[model samples]
Target: MTTPSAEPRPRFAADAMLGRLARWLRTLGFDTAYDPAVHDPELVALAAAEGRVLLTRDRHLVAHLRPERAGLITDDAPLDQLRQVVAACALAPPPALFSRCPVCNAQLRPATEDEAATLVPAASRALPGPVSRCPGCARVYWEGSHTRRMRQALSRALPGWIS
Candidate 1:
């Protein structure tokens, strides 16, 4: 049997049930579209229109889509769901961690120290590190304890993927 050629990592559109998984995928630098308000049919259409893989837990929905363009997520637990998607897609570690906004799904831009100081809480401003800001949500990000913890968790989940 011929091994399937590894495809370029796909962009994704996650159904409402996979919100957490979408955020994690975004955190890992994948372009994932997730809107809880988007109905299944619209999601399928959006995925098709945007050339995104549809990641869903609905068996019926998966059945309707081309198998090569969709993945059925079976796990209920968020972490397990994440692992399932990663494995299904053969995803690699993000080229840049925190490249996308977890809340709004927008790409993050580097924030100047002054901009970060103005946007972030005093505690976060006191930390010495570069920061990124989401242009859509205006949320500031820094390498604080929370980011460190998330990095640790991602490293554990993906193994040799996060640095």
Candidate 2:
């Protein structure tokens, strides 16, 4: 296995059962694209086309593929699944903050309150500080309790990660 620094951080495409894992990957700042009802062949094809590593739970789906982009998810639970992917991909360190949108798997850009004002929800606008904006989905983000829970959960699942 390649060391963390030596391994290239791969983009990802996750299968149906691994949605939680995909979301967690996005939280960890990986570019993870997830879709439900995607056939194995389609998943593999998407991975190839987009140059993303396929993340899945099915043994057969994970094993038979010849794509340079693939990793078999080893855990059934969300937290464990997240840990498995992180370790398997050798992405032990946290990636740059706000690099990805947690909801739609789009790339996020740093935006000021004025720049992101339209995208920002009224509740969010009235609420707080700087916001991150997803250019593809036009989703606005501000770190909150949900993000904190995700961070804490990830901290527990992957020790020494982002350290």
Find the candidate with the highest lDDT and give its number.
1
Pairs in steric clash, model 2? none
Q: Each candidate's lDDT (Cα)?
A: 0.83, 0.75
Q: Give the 10-residue window scoring lowest on summed lDDT in candidate 2.
A: 1-10
How well does each candidate superpose onto the true structure, as a TM-score?
0.90, 0.80
Clashes of each: 0, 0
Candidate 2 C-alpha lDDT tens digits along 1-163: 1223544676788988888888888877888888797888888899889877788778887667765667777778988887777666667576555578877888788777586667666666665545787888877777666656766776788876643
**What is the C-alpha lDDT profile of model 1 across 10-94, one tens digit per residue?**
7899999999999998998888999999988888889889878888888988777543478888899777888888777777666
Q: Candidate 1 at 93: error in angstroms?
A: 1.5
